[model samples]
Target: MKVLHFLSFFGLIASLSLEAAPKKENRKPNLIKPSETSQTSIENSFPKPKDQYQIRLIMENDAFGGFSDQYYTNGSRLEFNMKAGESNPTRRVLGYWNDLFITPTQSTKYLQGFSLGQEFYTPTNIEKADVSYGDRPYASRAYFGNSLTTATEDTSITTELELGMIGPSVGGKSAQMNFHNFIGSPTPQGWDTQIPNSYSGALRTDVRKFYHRFFGTQYNLNLGNIQADASFGLIFRFGNVDKTPGPGSSALQPGPPILHEDGTGYWYFYVNPGGTFQFYNATIQGLMGSDKSYKTQNRNTAFSNWDNYLNNPTQEAGEREIQYRALAEDNGKNSLQRYILFNEFLVNGTSNPYNIGLNYLLFNNIFNGAEDIEKSTRLFLLNNLAEQWDQIPDNARALAIYSIFRPEGGKLPPQIRLYSYEVLSQFILDPKQREVLLQLLRNEIEFRDEKTYVADLKRAVGFIKVGFVSVSNAGFLFGVHYNYQTIDFQSGKGLPQQHQWLGFQLGKVF
Candidate 1:
């Protein structure tokens, strides 16, 4: 009964947090500071336009952090003082202008305001050290009246790489190569894989749309070791016009437009029923705009398919069975959080990366009795990938479900038996293609125990064996061979509470 109630609770939590709610967007007063309204009309306030220069300073604070900027209006150029490292007095000078020299001509309407001022090229000095000079990697933008603008920016961080020259092979000095290898096991505790992060830089282009249902699109060309990917997504509002803005809406005023990590925004004004927005984030908004959820929603959708689904196909028996082989898993990593995923790398690719890969195996887990076959294979993968080469204990079973191909595998109690593997097999494609897909079933093929070694040197070299224990009226149910097996929690030992490890034990306790 305790296990039953716990399973029910786990199911409830998954349903609640994974669902998405409708979102809307629009422009608010924050974009154009209310106080800055006076400056827009300053030219007209005076009788004759004399030689008067304008100097403006702004300061802002928010949850993430704060920034201060100073702007001067003159052909002579502008200077900027940034207070990023606030705790310390060592502030940095971001830019210095040589009289707005690099700005486009005055008549470039719609985009005339955008320019990389001369000051942008000056070296960035921090802590009396010059990290970057006159290299304004930051892009420029110009606002066009009527809720539109165009901008381009490069948000790339470069990493220096030093490779080795051809080694000493003057006359065949014995061919030998040195390489570093990193592998991890996935436990319920978390990602056991130790992934080293890399520096990333990207070129961004954008177009802003800000009227109703604020929309935009952005394209990032990330350089360096980071993964390359192109993704499109959006956040739209759906509600009665009279309803307040977003989560921060008030009773008296219309809801506020959606906001991004940065104060900048690409927003739609008022959106009522019958309103719809389907576009790119880079379209109307500048490169840096608000659309955090867009990326996450896409990631979530991918996560939805990461696990195995109990799919029982209604196909007749004796039909051709499919096989999938990962000639080699492109375990490379990339920048965009989404790019790190396998599906994203495949689905978002212009050319199929999976067209030719390296994985070796025969047969797909699609047959009528595939459940038994897969359950058998799953234990092997789990044991081989574990800290100690043995089957997962009853208590750590939730952690065992971290690998792919099991939907009902999430942190569930071991009383369960998988019902379907068909739903998952459809994803692998044709029968021949399914061959060599042993990575999912045969993950531990590279490993073996003493019994396996003594059985048959060649054939048994690549197979792994695991154990299982379950509790019933018989005190305990134990199985020596690899199959859908179980172990009891609370009791530190395997089933029977005597010997839980495989290879050494044979037959069942019952």
Candidate 2:
């Protein structure tokens, strides 16, 4: 029965796509007449300006709906797009590779896009410290994506590839906990049980065709370690829609803005109804399988030993020192500790102070032909520098140190840049100073750059999305959307079978 329903859904999409599309003569004219002499007319009289490039930011969160904050809690992406032409390196490379596999199709236009995004998922009850058995696991993915789109009069096709990492290494825990702290929400305590670290990638292709002026059909296939699925959908547009030969805006789908021949601007409301057939979901089922137990055991042991050390009553000075050193080493290797450190490194590595200290550390340790230093020794020196600084009361000596470590403006070798922040952090003592370092590190991270289950899983899931888009003649764009999805999995915990969220988008074209 489930197989029949899924096949029927695909059949419906196929029939919809085959419907007689509106002819050019039947379409309403969007261009102004030259005789009207209106400002828009005057603008149209000039050669149509080409929109060669665009940048977009997309964000989605369940909290925006004023409802729950679990299961696909939050997501964000930044994307850059360009008209595909000989001048574009990404287009040339990807196009060449594409040609080797499938013959190129003739299309009126092409676009190439690149993006970086992060999203995290949690169980229904985020406040619980224990794993919510039979519910979704705490998981996060940070990925880089590349896409190529080709469009004709009333159709567009997009092929995209995404590569990323999943687990604690991606900083899901830090992102959620810190945000919750800022917002006064209960901290999510079960991230220690998040899926083990692993690399993930996906390839997806979508084909969409419009019928008349308001209706369209789409089909897509996705395959990867992260997920495997096929989906079909219908799209409807109303109001002052752009009749351009290109892709339409989607709040859930991160990509380039629709290319317009003239900067006339537009406003429209759209609805998309879709269904997906799932095969796999790594975020819920996990990729590490049996190895998950081993990793969890190690993490638990590390935390347990650290707790013991902190509460121990033995007070021998020498023994305490030895224990402290050993604990620091162990904590350094702890998954949570590493997650925090990774986030800190990414968030603080770009500050002037951080870079200055990093440069100095690199110069001494790697570039100056000094004796090679062990990573542990370097870590110890960096960690203890602030304590050492407190003993030196001479302000002149501090100034001298700052002057010696200040950045001189040449790029450091790329290999050591990510690790250099540890040393750089040693120089920062004030809370505000540390904040400055962290802000820079985050800037660099940004500015620089599913599995299916079996009987517990629904074979088909349906979703609906409604949104409005507004664009300025100056090329600025903004949109807000509401999305709802039918349950794709059965948790049997009285958790809601329906989930809804809000999405926001902002973009600019040049």
Candidate 3:
């Protein structure tokens, strides 16, 4: 019944998004032309001046949508855009980077943009003082971005680089708390468990092609620790639209300046429907190879027993039994302890071949070192491994295992290999024996054929934006948009699957 309700809601939104705008002939024609008026003139009596520079301030807040404060809560950006030329520092820097991928043509006009932005996310139950393991983590990202765009009449290509910091230093906690106090909302309690501070950088490239005045397609590729995904989508526009170099709106990001040839006003409604192939999202899954400790357990003592067991092999069976019992006592107290126990059980006493396959699968796929493999595939494989593990042939497993650990080349991180060595070193005692055991474990990872695992993280996202751009004869510009987006990720229990926000922009042409 709940699924049906969501489906119905999405259907209604789609209908509204695709509604055609009223025809121009249906509207009353303006009889007077004013030199300066609050509203824009449909027709310009004189030639419009070319804009050389633009500065814009953009703000987005979910509170405007009247939704709960969870997930993507708030964001803001300040942007400056200018014509790209040899004298521009941003153009000179990004131009060199762009040349590596695409050579600019003579007809291509270049525009450079620089921006500073901050965005933050929260879990469903913000009032909870403890971490919510099943929900998305609390995260904040503040970045400075520089981008270069090359455009013609029908198409545009943009390459952007963003460098920033993620975590408490970004002031997400203070910002949210202060705002909540101002609005008389419940204070978020889980910010103490937010993702730790870390340096982050990402490269993003977008290509947009307009097939007709009102229709176009856009493709985007993003790579970095913060997000890794590829997306393709179609764009539809109606009402009074202009011939912009790229997508008319930057959505949430900073965009190139709009070129208004006649300094007149224009307004449009647009719908963007798209699907993304997600690879990794550090904001949800945590950073790769990060050693930061969380509030879940006592970091110093969480693995003391396991470490002791690995460091001492000559201990009596009775003594080993006592250590194992101690671990059992600590289990269920916290997430970290439970995880350790699970790994230990798989390593010491799991007789089922299927369970053995699962152990290797969890370690290899979850802690993947390869950059090309999709991180979401690990979740899919784990969910289905039980039903399919027995079907894999032994010889195939051998070949796969051999290929993964060829001695001369392996992609596993040094930290993971070292951790594995520490665990085995105690039992093997001898260096040579331990090396052989490590190789055997690596071979076990190939039990299921690599080709058998399929990625299942593709999700469709829907966007509806209704906005207007007005440029005064004096070169002033202002716009406001109401934006709505369907679920972008798989929401956890008791979480909203849709989000909406409002954006306001104020700019000037100099």
Give the Cα lDDT of each candidate. Answer: 0.20, 0.59, 0.57
User: What 10-residue stretch in candidate 1 is worst by lDDT?
Assistant: 448-457
TM-score of candidate 3 on Cα atoms, chains taken together: 0.55
In angstroms, the error of model 2 at 455 is 11
Span of 10 residues, lowest total lDDT, candidate 3 = 448-457
Model 1 Cα lDDT, one tens digit per residue, 1-510: 655565557557745754653444763444766346445445444456222111111111110111111010011111111112223221111111111212323321111111111111000111111011111111111111111111112111111111111111111111100100111111111001001112223222221222343322222221212212232222233322211121111110001111111222222232111111212212111122222212110111111222232132334211212111121111111112222232333223333222111000011111110111245556555444454424323422333342224432122111211111222222444554333232332322122100010000011111112222222232221212221111111111111211111111111111
Candidate 3: clashing pairs of residues: none
Residues 1-510, candidate 2, lDDT per residue (tens digit)?
A: 654565567557756875865456566664755344345434554675465788888888888888788777888888887888767666665565444333455645678888788988876766443333345567788999888776666666667789999888999988888888888776676576677788989987777777755788877777898778888888888867645423344434543355555457777788989999988767765673533331211222111232353444455434533432332222111323433443343335444332222333433322121122334645554554454555433432343243234332112222233234334444533465445544454443232221121114467889888888877777787888888887666553345678888988888878
Model 1 RMSD in Å is: 32.0
Identify the candidate with maximal lDDT. 2
Provide the RMSD of all predictions against the true structure, rounded to 1 decimal.
Answer: 32.0, 20.9, 22.0
lDDT at 377 for candidate 2? 48
For residue 129, model 3's alpha carbon misses the true position, in angstroms, by: 1.3
Error of 3 at 494 (Å): 3.5
How good is model 1 by TM-score?
0.19
Model 3 score (lDDT): 0.57
